[model samples]
Target: MRRLVIVNQKGGVGKTTTTANLAAALVRRGWRVLLIDMDPQAHLSIHFGFDPESNEPTIYDVLTQGTSVTEILRDTEEGLRLLPACVDLAAAEVELAGVDDRHYLLRNALSPVENEFDAILVDCAPSLGLLTLNALCAGFEVIIPLQPHFLALQGLMKLGQTVALVRARLNPMLRIAGVVVVMQDSGTLLSAEVISGLEQILAAHRRSGDAWGDARIFSTRIRRNIKLAECPSHQTSIFTYAPKSNGALDYAALADELFGTAAAAPVAPADAAPPVAAATTRDPRDAEDAAPSESSMRTATA
Candidate 1:
């Protein structure tokens, strides 16, 4: 299965929204999709009608307690299956702190069911902690959702650095699939400027050629749509909430663009042996101070 991690250290850039809609769109296109919510907030689960307060098993249990992923998996509309998250996941960092090979905990948990899904989308938390590390180690393709803002560019840089580190240490096959601009308003001058800057950066990297192998910026920009924000409140995807809405159309285009090129490749087998020593480093947050408030979830929905 092709594992795609929808990640952005900046929360408001629409990572969760992209994960939800993209999975829905892929399901519509006849792919078996698995959506994994790695955020402690459980926003993805709640968006799909899961209540963390209930007694049902969550991704927290699957990763920390070795619960079977198939047992906790639940089907959604349009044939997407979700591995829900709960608030307890917030404590996983401390709980797994002293454990060995903590970084590969998630990868080990998901290894058994890797072949069950055609596509696995991981919705990561806003911070660069154990949870996000798990996602980086588990997935081969990284899909960064960016907003058209100067600060978002900085966040993207940090995320790119993290991905590079992960590749150097953990997963050698990991690569950035592409960068996606979300909540774009083409009519605004600021948005236009950010777009220009992004293109310049991408073009420079292309000229260098060695920095990025095959990664390219996606052409389908996701426009700000009220329908997209509204759908999560009703626990539905944009397609089910309003199929004709711009939100649905944009996500469908993105899905088409993503799968049209990579659909035929077979999923990689899970890592059977235990992870090596490098994956067990302490939390990156403890070494440095917490990310600035502006870089955290402050702009989560913007």
Candidate 2:
């Protein structure tokens, strides 16, 4: 299975939206997908109509109270399984501070049920706290959701440094999958300039052998779509809310690039092992062909 963490410290860049839609798109292509909401806001849960205040077991229970992932698992109408979160999850960092090897909590909790799904994507909050650290530890591939703007570019260099630190000290197999440009406005000169700036920085990282060496800006730019923002209020994925919308088309194209297609889906064992054991035979895609070429990026996005 592909264990991915969709993360970015910058808010309003579409991390949660990308995670939700990407999982839905993957499921639509015949893969069983699981979503883990590591964010304390529980926005991911609410996107699927899950009640954070319904008194049901949640990811907070699993993190602090030793609840199994299956206990809190909820099925979406669109075939995705979710590990919902709530406001109470915000306290876990403080609660887990005193524990031994706190970083491994998520990696450990996932081993038991990871084999049941073809993909597991974690939605992290807009911080580099303990919660996000746990996600970095558990995930093998990191997918960064970026916005093509000058201010947005500043945070990526810092985020890349954090990922490098974590890879060296926490998870060696961890690598950046790619950057998905969201809320894109292709007609703006600022968008083109920001994308060019991104290319230069990433190329430098590659030459310097940094954490973002294998990363690239995916060509599938999620255009500004009101339906994407609207779907969350209706408690459903964009695919189900507006199948013919730009939001759905963009995310579906992303899913195709990431997992290929139904006939040639991502290659992983049906009954895969845990992160520690599975790291030995890491996915080749994790470290290959993701670096974006300037010409190709422009050809596709322009």
* CA deviation > 4 Å runs, candidate 1: 207-212, 261-302
RMSD per model, one decimal: 11.7, 9.3
Positional deviation of residue 302's Cα in model 2 after best superposition, in angstroms: 30
Writing each residue's lDDT as its tens digit, candidate 2 over 1-302 gives: 79899989977778899999999887766678999999988999999889999989998888888899889999988778999999989999899999888888888888899888889999999888889999999998999988776676777777888889999999998988788888776467778888888888888777566678778888777776678889999888887887766677778778867877555654434552211111112233432213333332221110
Alpha-carbon lDDT of model 2? 0.81
lDDT of 1 at 289: 18
Each model's TM-score, in the order given? 0.84, 0.86
Clashes of 2: 0
Give residue 105's error in model 1 in angstroms: 1.4
| lDDT for 59 (candidate 2) | 88
Q: Write the per-residue lDDT of candidate 1 for residues 1-302, one digit (tens) a residue.
A: 78998888877779999999988876665567889999989999999988988979998898788898889999875567999999999999888888888888888988888887888999999888899999989998999888876666776666777887888888877888888888875466666787787777667666443324566789888877678889999899988887766677778778767876223324423432211111112333432212223333234332
Model 2, residue 18: C-alpha shift (Å): 0.4
Instruction: Note the Cα lDDT for every prediction shown.
Output: 0.77, 0.81
